[model samples]
Structures are given as C-alpha cells and as structure tokens.
Target: MLVTIVSLWAQKLFRLDEPQPFGGAELQLTLLAKALVKRFGVEVQFITRGQGPFEIFEVDGIRVYKLAYRDFPPARTILGSWDLLRLLLSLKTDIYVQRGGGIETGIVGMASRMKNKPFLFMTSHSWDVDGTHEKNRGWIYGTLYMTGLRRAAGIVTQIQNQHDLLWHNYGRESLVLPSAHEIPAPIPIKKEGVMWVSRCETWKCPHVFLRLAEALPDLRFTMVCPQANSRELFLEISQKAAALNNVTFLPGIPFEETEPLFATHRLFINTSEKEGYPNTFVQAFKWGTPVVSLHVDPDAILSTRELGVCANGDETALRNAVKQMYCDEGWWKKYSENARSYANATHNVQVIVEKFYSLLQSLKK
Candidate 1:
C-alpha cells in the first residue's frame, strides 16, 4: 500500500518551519519514509499545497509531488480541496497520512471517501494544540477544527496525554504515536552565553528575554530569530537588550548552522505561547542546552520532571529563573542533563518510529 502525506505547508523553496537541513517535520518524514521504503518497500508520495510551482523531487530517495496551490480563505481549512483531491484520485492512495493537527483533516477525509482511501489523522494535542488560540480566530473556524477532527478514519496523537480528549470529544479511535526527534550525536562546539532560539514572533515572548538581559548585565544574551517584517518590533527589542553589554543579535541561521549554536550556547530559552513538542527543545536536549520556557501542556516530558521551570507569564519569576540558571552555575548543568536524558529515552526517533510502524501494520490488518 502506498502512503500519501497530504499537507498544506509542504513547499519547494523551504519556508521558516520547513525541515532545516538538520531536522524538523520534514526530517522526521524523511527518516521514516526512507526506512519504510528500504525495509517495507512501500511506495511513499507527498501531496502539498505549495504555492510556487508544480514539480517533483527526490527527498531522502522518496518521491514528493510539489503541487501548486492558490491561496484561499479559512473555509478550505475545513471543506475545500483542490490539488488534494486531484492527488488522491490520481494516486488512488491506500493510506493517507497527515502531520499532527490541522483543519485540513476533514477535507482530506472527504476526498478519501470519494477515492475509497482511508487516512490516519495525527492529532497533536491534549485538548487543543498548546494555547487553543484558534478558538478565538472566529466561530466558523473553531467549529471547523472539531468538524475536521471527528470524521477521520483513524486518529493518531503524538502523546498519550491527548488520547482522552480525542476519545471523549471526537470519539477517540486513535493510536498513540508519541512524538520523536533524531538524537544527533554530541557535537563538540563552542557557544558562549545565554541563547534563545525560535521564530521571532510575538507569541515567543522575545520581550521577556529583553527583560532578562536588562536584569543580568554580566551574562551574554543572544537571540536567533527568523528575519521577517517584524523589524520594528525587533529593533525595539535590540535597543532594550543593548543596555546589557553582553547582549548580541544573530540572524535566523538555517538548521544546519544550529548544531554549533546549540552546542555552544550555555542555556536555551523557550518563549512560545504554545507548541506540540517543540523541535527546539529536542535540539537543546541533544546539545545539552537547558531551557527556561513558558508553560506548555503537550511537553509532558519536560513538565513531569519539572526540569524546565514552566512559567505562566511571570516576569519576576522569569528574572529569578535566569538567575538560578546562570548565577547558581551548577543548577544549569543539572537541568540540561535532565532534559537530555529524558529526550534520549522517551522521544528517540527509533522508538517513536517503531510505534508508527506498529500502527501502520495494524491498519493493514
């Protein structure tokens, strides 16, 4: 049976969230796809709504069809399907695989019915993803999230924490496919000072780190953020951090450049409002970099150990956490070790991939 991954974000040029040469969803897909192809000899194809152009490429020896898509309003997230329908019919896919969570699930399921294909919808959340911010987007949008979720042939959640929510609200019937990331071998690299890595969006709370920089003048502060139109806000942050002689700014480097950065950075900070098992935190663990992040529920691995000080938007607490992390010295190492060990055991790619392989095999039977 051929596996067709239908996604809206898969693109040709590589967007900000695209798998860096190092790792991300694309890397995860690549690893599993290569293994599936080599071991099972199953055919794997990808259908994406990438806007640029339509073409094909060999990613990790797997075939990807970069189908072009035009922009649509929110309705498509739930009911609309243009190329997605076309790809499904053309390939007569046996199993449809979509990443964690997205409103596109319903439309894909609809198309699958038309083409007689069953899909595994991977729901990456406990209740709602992270902040559940989509609820505030609009009434119809919120309803679509649930509508798209409930009608899937099968559901797959990254963590067991989310199983009850899907089972109760969406009628569960999903396998628990825990999240995973490749454990990059330890890289001997040098990074100096405190570092924060993530999209430079408002949700990441870059301003909070600016406050930390102000509080700790002696320690070095570095932020690696995507270069986007948020220049005005970034400039404002840079100025605020400037007061601390140790603070510096670096452009958003590609994932390939991140190993050395993660290796060298003494500390890692996660300032996001929400996430479904962050790629950055896994990188931090692999690199032995500890993080101080705002509270996010899906990261149960970090939350259980309390290895990460989950902040609830408390600036004073943020200040104190920074002090404890840097000023105490030994505290940082302990937390870093904790984060690394947890990731090594719990979220290792091989183990997680085995879980996925089991689910696929079960679906076949």
Candidate 2:
C-alpha cells in the first residue's frame, strides 16, 4: 500500500520561493517533505494558510492546499474551525502530521480519528512539550492542544530535553529526532563579521544582541530579524540597530540567501530564551561557522562537542564568548570544524528522512 503523509501547518509551501513569515518548524517540515518524496517515494502534501479562498497548487513534488479564512470574534471562529475541519477531512491521507502547539492540533486530531488515520505530533519548541505552554498560551489554547497531543499516535521531539519534559509532565513517550537540513557541499569562503538571525519577538532578546554589538565596536554585526508578533517592535529594533555604526540591520532575507551569510560569517549568535534545536544553529554548523548562544544549548551538545559557547543566560558572558570566538583563531577554527562534523553526521536530510519513513511505516502496521 502507498503511504501518503500530510503536513498540516499555516505557512508558505517552500522557503526559497517566498520571502514570507515562517519559523524553524516550517523549514524543517519542508526539508523532511522534499526528502521523503525524493528518497523513499512516499507521497507528501501540505495544508497551509494563504491569501485567497481554499485552493490547491503544486510546488516541487508536494501538493499544497491553502486555507485562507479569519478566526475573528463571535461567529467567524466557528466558521473558521468548520472550514479547517472540512479541509482536513478532504485530504484523507495515510497519516497527518502537525508541528508545534496550536488549536489546529485538536482539529487535525479530530479529523484523523474520524478518518481512522494516525496523527503524528512533532514538537517544534521547548514550550510545546515543557508543560509551560498552558500558562504561557492561556488555558483554552492549552486545552485544545493537549486534547490533540493526547490523541497523537506518535510524538517526535527535536531534542532529549523535550522528550524528557514530555514524559515527566504528560507521561508521553516520544522519539528524539534532530531538525533535518540539506547538507551542502563544503565551499571555501572568507568568513568575517558576526550574524544574528531570528524573528523579532520579545522572547528572542534582540536587544541584548544590540548591546553586544555596542560592547565590541571593532567587529561588524549583522541582524537578520524578521517581524514576528509585532511590526512596530520590528521597526523599534531596526532603529536601535541603525544607531550603532558597527551593526547592520536587515528586515529579512530569503531562506536560500541565508546560507551564504552563514558560510561567510565568522560567528552565528542566538539570543532566544528557549528553542527546539534551532534551524539556524544547524545552518551555521553545516557551514562550519561557530555559534554563541545566550541561553539554549539543546542537549548540551554545544559544550559537549565544543561546537559553540552557551552563555547560560548571562549577557556579559555572551558578549565575552562572542569576543573570544572572534579574536581567537585557533579556538574559532576548532569549534567550526567540530560544528560542521557534528551537523553533517546528525542532520543529513536523507538519513533523517529514512528514520522518519521507518516510523511512519511502522504506524501503518
């Protein structure tokens, strides 16, 4: 029997095709979908949010269905939910997969049960599995998400931290998987400048990075933050970065355009308070560039493998670590080589997709 997997997420179909708003989970999903179709011949599809009414289109090998409806206030919420349910049931795939925590989790779960299909929940952030989402996202969002999470046939976590949290908090067992990435051939490029890339959200602490840039006036800094949650906040951060001569602020760039930045940047910095194995980290590592993170370590692989430095939530320490990575060539080269080796060994898309395929096949039995 042929296995068809549907990825349910409200995002663009592909990374390079659109300069739109998307996160690490969407990027990982796109990579996994492409690899599954190319290497294993499994049929893959996507249900995303777009500008128009319900429509279907094909990009690469995946068929994408767009759901464009507002979930505003009293009555439209019900209409929106009904429309989403109709779309989910219409797909009728072998398995339905959703990443991150949202009301769609419950919606997809209901559709899967109605269709007798297995639903897979992929954890995309630490908050999704750590029992904090209930308090963070409020009770209603949590209730709907938990309903779906409990109904999931299988769960996949990007790190052991999420797996442990899932088990401890909810008594759910999950397979630990790394975020998938396409491992590009090694290209020699002159690496310079420090780069920080993420959505301009409050929790991301983009302000801290500005301070780091101010502290180290000699080294050039690049910020590729896209607007997230608030556009006014994005403009605010952009203006702040513009005030500093050493810092260059970009609203955003295409996903394909970022790899060259990663390859040529001397350091990749992450200021997020928490994450689920950031795709940017994998990108930097794959490009043989060292990372300096403010908080997240994701399985402590950064320190364990000497791939990068984790400041452990201290701003001064983060600044110092970036300075050290930039100034010390021997230290920087060592981390860069280790990062590339670890990323290629663990996150190769073909290998990761094979593991995902095996899991999906087992579910069929």
Best-performing candidate as measured by TM-score: 2
Q: Which residue pairs does candidate 1 place in steric collision?
A: 167-172, 191-264
The lDDT, on a scale of 0 to 1, for candidate 2 is: 0.83
lDDT of 2 by residue, 1-365 (tens): 23434343435444233434788887888888878778887777787764556777777788777666453543434566677788778765888888888777888788878888888889988888877767777776778788889889999999888899999999999999898888889655679999999989999999999999999999999999988768788989999999999998988787887888998999999999988889999999999998999999999999999999999999999988998889999999899889889989999887898899898887763
Q: What would the per-residue lDDT of candidate 1 be over residues 1-365, giving only the tens digit for each residue?
A: 67887655545223444421222444455556666776667788866555456777766556778666554554444234555666667775677777654455655666666766667777543435432525564655456455556556677766665666556654565676655667776645444588887656676678777777777888888887654447777677666666667777765566667667878887777777766666677777777777777655454555577566766667787667767876665777677778778778877877877777767766652
Off by over 4 Å in 2: 1-10, 13-20, 69-78
Clashes of 2: 0
Which pairs, if any, clash in model 2? none
The lDDT values for all models are 0.65, 0.83
How do all models score by TM-score?
0.82, 0.94
RMSD of 1: 3.9
